[model samples]
Target chain A: MFDFNIVTQWLDTLLMSFLPAWATVLIECVLVALAIITLYAVFAIVMIYMERKVCAWFQCRLGPDRVGPWGLLQVFCDVLKMMTKEIVNFRKTDQLLHRAAPFLVVTASMVTFSCLPWNKGAQIIDFNVGVFFFLAISSIGVVGILLAGWSANNKYSLIGAMRSGAQIISYELSIGMIMLAMICLTGTMSFSEICQQQENLGWNIIRGHVPAVLCFILYLIAGNAECNRGPFDMPEAESELTAGYHTEYSGMDFGYYYLAEYMNLFICAGIAATIFLGGWAAPLIPDWEMWNEIMLYVPGFVWFLMKVFFVLMLLLWERWTFPRLRIDQLLNLEWKYMLPMTMALLVVMAICVSFGFIWN
Target chain B: MENKSYFSGLFSGIKSLCTGLKVTGRELFTKKVTERYPENRKNNTVSERFRGVLAMPHNENNEHKCVGCGICEMNCPNGTIKVESEMVEVDGKKKKQLVRYIYDHGSCIYCMLCTRSCPHGAITFQPEFESAVFSREALVKQLNKPGSKCAEKPAPARPAVAPKPATTADVTTPVAPAAPESDDKVAKLVAAAKKAADNAAAAKVAAEEAAAKAAAAPEDADLKAAADEAAAKAAKLAIVADNVAKKVAEAQA
Candidate 1:
């Protein structure tokens, strides 16, 4: 009922009829860019607020409730405060790379966000290698993190950046293998195609049974590690590294990193929603036509968001619940355990896919 | 066995993680412990014993318990308290009255010495923690309100274990009541005790006087009579002293 394609299509057609083709394409690009930026701002504000509340609730404390009703406008106030703050410059720092780092990280997050199939016909870019594209773009953020750390001319930043580099790089393997296993089941790397296939094949987790479930669990673990959130947040270990890679960052420069972190969380959850949980697909009750019909009537956009938020909550739950892992333990978890498990699971998924043992 | 242990270890690790999540999950829906201060100031309460600031409480009649003994000032390690007093005529008698009970809250370590050391229980810590002020002078508070009078009735002093009664009637009342004949006997005993006490005192004075006169006039005839009189007095005083000690021991028993 609330499909966003109708508005987007109408806008596209309206612009096409009144303007030149080049100008129309340019306007569409500008609109999409504006939409993505606006989405980033909204998500950053929302996720930060949600995370604070979740963290507070877990600790038996009431979170922010002063700025606006339920502290809804707290993030906006924080943004304003951050904007007016002085981006302090260090004497011996590499000014150029330090300045460019936040932009790079934010750009990487935005690019990855565009690749996700938000709803049917609502995706910004429907790349054939969408999953691979997401993986590639997301890893580019680590480069920005490393640059920020190294250029800060500080020991803490250097160590934090180095730790982040090691953790993200290693965990990326497990993440890739899990996605590969999913792709093996669906026979496509394109997120939209995988999502559509899951709708027909009764959600990959349901169809592939054991291996798929294993894939989902491993993917959450790997994705969590990839995001550099606890229990895998070794680089920006606040207790040890004093905000890790972004130690020297201040003002809106630091705000970018902060925004990107939350946005990265959304992206991680979004990927999980698209791959394992059927992106934009309404949850159906087996053998219950009435329930299926009712669920199907709800907008795909709403379903997509519900799944994303569910995954986001799971990530938030674990983040608040678990303590930060030691650096050695982090690396050991990936290399000795998660990576090997993903590899074994990928093989099992391959066999299941070849034997046509899927549920649907 | 090795493989079994490995799998069990992994399973237990995941289970432990789930257990942690469950604890926080349960806490998430539980009632939050946050007290929104300032907004909830109306509902906020502090412990009765919370030492926030020194205050001398006044009754409805605006009378305080401070006697201005300066004990609190003496006990204060940081010179946080200053108790000043002035002698004022009350019913034609000079009485030390509290003029200013200056309490420098700025310098107060909140060691509770001032409150604990107040002999009259005059000063106590009031749980009014919002004592922040802009001016340094504001922290130096005068605990005694202006135009307030000192409480007329002092707090009752602690009772002692034993008391000395002056009269026979007073002594008999503290002890168990006896027969009417015993009351008369007690009175006569008390009269005799009083006489013995006076004679002992007189003998002591005479003995001293005789000794001094003997030392002055070695060949005087009256010196022998005076010595003899002193010796007789001493002997009688000794007898009286023994009888008084026996009566005192009997009374105690």
Candidate 2:
């Protein structure tokens, strides 16, 4: 009989026999780094095209249809253009920090994917404190924004950086508290374990009571603010700040920052799907015997992508529909509204856990 | 109340998100509207009154009636026209021939003043205004018709003046008969003066009536002001009444 446990044990034994511990670790790190980079690049390109198309649709025009059958290569042409352009560093700027900011920001976002559980047994590093590690590492992107804003030597960038500092720091609390509620219900910080727990009980969204759902919604909003996405993208408000933190970044330097943003978006959505929607869990199909037989042929990375893509589409839809939140409005939504709401939800979730309202 | 359950807000948030999704879903299927610029430009036609380059028309006789009079040159406010006249010998008589009538279409305001001021029935406005060109020199147009010779001339001018009348004795012989004629003329002049005086009196009466009507303008203005104030007050009262009715309906519900 092909039990899931034996399958894992056999694979572990085979891996141990063939490779040294350090060599195996090295291979995994290399593979994960390659996958993350490749995925980020692909998504960033696709997202740019999608955004243009969405904008065009809303404004009542056909977008990018001529490039290569619906303007798929439009982003490529744009990227090529941007790559060839000159990077102009202004006379008044902290050259060192200005140069280093985007690279660091993008690197920070890329590093978060190292701990995410792609599928059942597919992950770069199955760290025990995976969720915490992701939270800790991804928040470092704010440093990039701060560096970009301060080093540009423009007042708009400085003000934008300051606003970003306030925004990320505030929204992070609500996001953290919301994630903490999930941690309470799941009783683990490991993303894979959390997903596994959900598989045992339909989905955390359905199983973990009303407060957990509230936490999920709050986390989504806070995550949006953290990434400086619409309704919360005050950092790069073109109308108010002429591109906010990256006002001075041009050519490939600007491109790097842009790529990092979309990369962060994918990473955030991946985390959200893993935490709430039961990552790669086949839902309500009822043909488990057939699914189990075919599941092996389908790679874990593909499942991860399927789930991530769905979440990305949802996020894009949100971006198109919602009007952006003002800076003061954004902060109030965080400190006054989201923080308190998430805190109360956490308390309620705690009560539900103690009373066995979950998994009943 | 028992800490009104806060899940209501969460439910509302989910509801709003669903509503947004529905809207986007509908939009995804709608036909797109885009004007392909190059394609449209190939078939595009401009309106008749598009105000393009100005042109002056020449007659069927292959002759421009420009008399070298320089009226068009003087009337062109922008100095877009230059008319040069030359003294040419026609049949051994001197005449002013129009050597050149140059028009710079670039500076023309399309005011049609030059066309209107041609006193010799020379030029008329033409509607063929599409005169965009690459070079500035291409915009300059020569008004003179090709191979057209200058018209022949007449002789020079002559002034006419007469001698003054004689005085005293010449006046005495004619003055005796002229005296009676002068009396009759004086009476006719007196009659004409009386009729003029009557017309002046009638005109004065009409002027007084006009002045009286002008004096009543302020009263009409005051009446209109009062009417406007009443209408504004009525609109405000209607708005207040509507608000009250809405509140009453809510209370009843």
Candidate 3:
């Protein structure tokens, strides 16, 4: 009932009736790009507000409640304030790279977010190597950080950028390994195909069982570490690095960086939801026919959002609960602990996939 | 031994992480302790002894205990208190009468020395704290309300018995023999406040009439100018009225 493809198809026909095919295609591209940007910005705003509220709740305090009702408009006011602030730059800074850094970061996040399968046939880009594309695109954010830090000619920014570069590079291995473990079980790199397989197979987590759950946990850790969130947030360690790689940035430039960070969190949560927790697949009982029928009545997009927010909550929970890990401990955890665990889990996943020991 | 310790350490570390999660998770649903200031201002309580600002206790009759002793002014370390007193003839006797009790809240350190050292106990700290203002001049307050009399007669101008206990029954005596020029100034301020308010009301009515005229003659430049002029006059008069009303309140307070 909530299939978005039908609406898109109707619009497609209406546009085709009036416009040339090339123009129609160009306009559709622009529309999708605009939609993706809007989604990215909206998710950033929601996630930031959610993070604050969740953090406040965790600490046994009322968060922002003075701006609007329950302080819902606080973020909008914050955005306005940030947008109007004077953009300051150091005279010695590399003007071009410094200017381009925030945009690059935002673009990287925006590109990765567009590939997410929100519902049945609602993906903007159905890339053949969808999982790999997300992995590759997400890493470009660190490059932006490095550019911002190096361009600023500030010691703290440079150190922060270097640390982030190191942290993301190391964690990327664990993320890739964990995804590989899932890939072994699901037998597809395309996100939609993986999700579709989860429909009948009763979610890769239940199908692959032990190894899948291990991969899920490990993937969350890797995702949190990669996002530079707390516990693994050695790069933007405010106690030491002030504001880290974007220390020199101000006004909307700094705002873009902030937006990109939260967007990255959402992207990570979305990926985890799609891969491990059954993207838009509703949870069903094995023997209850009536229950299965009831589950099918709810829309897939809502299920997708539920799973994504659940994962997002877990990420934020981990962030606020744990203290920041030292840089040494961060790399040590990745190389020593997370890496070995994923490798062993990958082998176990391969055995499960080969033996047909998964649920159907 | 090393492998056993390593594996045990891993399990323990995982357990501790879970314990931390459980702690924070439990806290998530617990009662929040935020004060929600501004929203809960009525229920919010400051300590009774909280030295917010100094204020003179004027009785229901608008009479204060300060007999222009100036001891509170001398005890103020920051010179925050400036007690202006003048000689006045009451019952054909010259007595020191308080004209103004200027208290600079911005400079006051809240030391309470002025409140404590007052022999007559004329002033004390009030708990009314939300005293923020835009300008520094607003922080400097005239504590004694305008035209308020001393609670008692000046004790027959006895210099030796300056710390005599105030008698409320003595309020039947003649109040401050206010100088003629000071009385004229107060009258002038009250007149100005009334005049400004009337001018604002007149300008508003004129603007409304001009707006109606402009509506009738859409293409008339002169009519529009008249309307704009009337609106401007109303706006200026409204501001003047606001200032004068504030001055009137200050005078009365």
* Per-candidate TM-score against the hidden true structure: 0.76, 0.62, 0.69
Best by DockQ: 1
Looking at chain B only, the TM-scores across the models are 0.54, 0.40, 0.48
Residue pairs clashing, model 1:
none
Give the C-alpha miss distance for residue B206 in model 3, angstroms.
85
- Report lDDT per candidate: 0.85, 0.73, 0.87
Candidate order (DockQ): 1, 3, 2
Residue A177 lDDT in candidate 1: 94
Q: Which segments of candidate 1 are over 4 A away from where they belong?
A: A1-24, A85-92, A348-358, B1-9, B58-71, B85-100, B117-121, B144-253
True contacts kept of 2: 0.50
| Candidate 1 residue lDDT tens string, B47-152 | 8999899899999999999988898899999788888899998899789999999999899888998778887789899898998999999998999999997887
DockQ scores for all predicted structures: 0.64, 0.30, 0.61
Residue-by-residue lDDT tens digits, candidate 2, A42-102: 8788778877887677656788877887888889999999999999988889999999999
CA lDDT of B252 in candidate 3?
51
Candidate 2 chain B: worst 10 consecutive residues by lDDT? B159-168
Per-residue CA lDDT of model 1 for A32-67, tens digit only, reads 999999988888888999999888998999999998
For residue A85, give model 1's deviation from the true position in Å.
Answer: 4.1
